[model samples]
Target: MRWNNATTGRWTHRLIPNLTPWLQRRHGQVDFYLTQMISGHGCFKEYLHRFKHEPNPYCDHCGTGSIEDAEHALFICPLFVRYRAEAETTTVCNLTADNVMSCTLESQSKWDAIANMAAGILKELRRRERSRRIQS
Candidate 1:
């Protein structure tokens, strides 16, 4: 199944099985910030400001024209589309649907694989952005 936002949380809960231990092992401010960043609710002022911009902060790739939420960053970005194409067979389909019902149901392993691919794509995008900033 596709791991859209709603189902992604549920999938995380199901897969982790032992949230307390995981949290304890990773306990730190960095973990907290990462959680917020992944969930689209980090308290960072600059991050928040990005969503409030006039063009709606939609992804440059997908052109969703809405708040550049976490879902958009991870899934809807057009840049990721190219990344996925290049990495064929390792890419997960980003659910652009409004609800979880639209997500394709897949095995747990498949979902995990896709999630990992998504993470890698996001990391690459960040790396590209950093390189661009350094170049400018």
Candidate 2:
């Protein structure tokens, strides 16, 4: 299966083991936030540092000296704890890198809840990134 064999898009694969349901059910554009969360190729510090846009991959908000990869931003960042908690409560599922796909695919409401939460967090991250750039 392409799901297990692909080197990239592991995050996406984790959430969408079979594309049929997602393709058939999914509506509207994927949006900037969800694309970055799945592809790990957007404004994330780890991705930016990898591309030499950032000096370091560490999360400026968490203070734990952890790399600010998509997984960290999605699941572990205290900066977005409220958004994460709200999504969990709304979806009735514990969010995890491995389980996000399943949880989101559970229902239309679950999908909307997760997508909104992700958008909120990523948009804030993008805003913070832009502010840092302007200050520097």
Per lDDT, the best of the predicted structures is 2
lDDT of predicted model 2: 0.81
C-alpha lDDT of all candidate models, in order = 0.43, 0.81
Candidate 2, which ten residues in sequence have the lowest lDDT sum? 1-10
After superposition, the stretches of candidate 1 with alpha carbons farther than 4 Å from their true spots are: 1-37, 41-67, 82-94, 97-106
Tens digits of per-residue lDDT for model 1, 20-98: 4434442223233235434445422225556652223444455555444555554555655654443334324434323
Model 1 lDDT at residue 126:
60
Alpha-carbon deviation at 72 in model 2, angstroms: 0.4
How many steric clashes between backbone atoms does each model show?
4, 1
lDDT of 2 by residue, 62-126 (tens): 75479998889889988899999999999988899878866777787887888888898888888
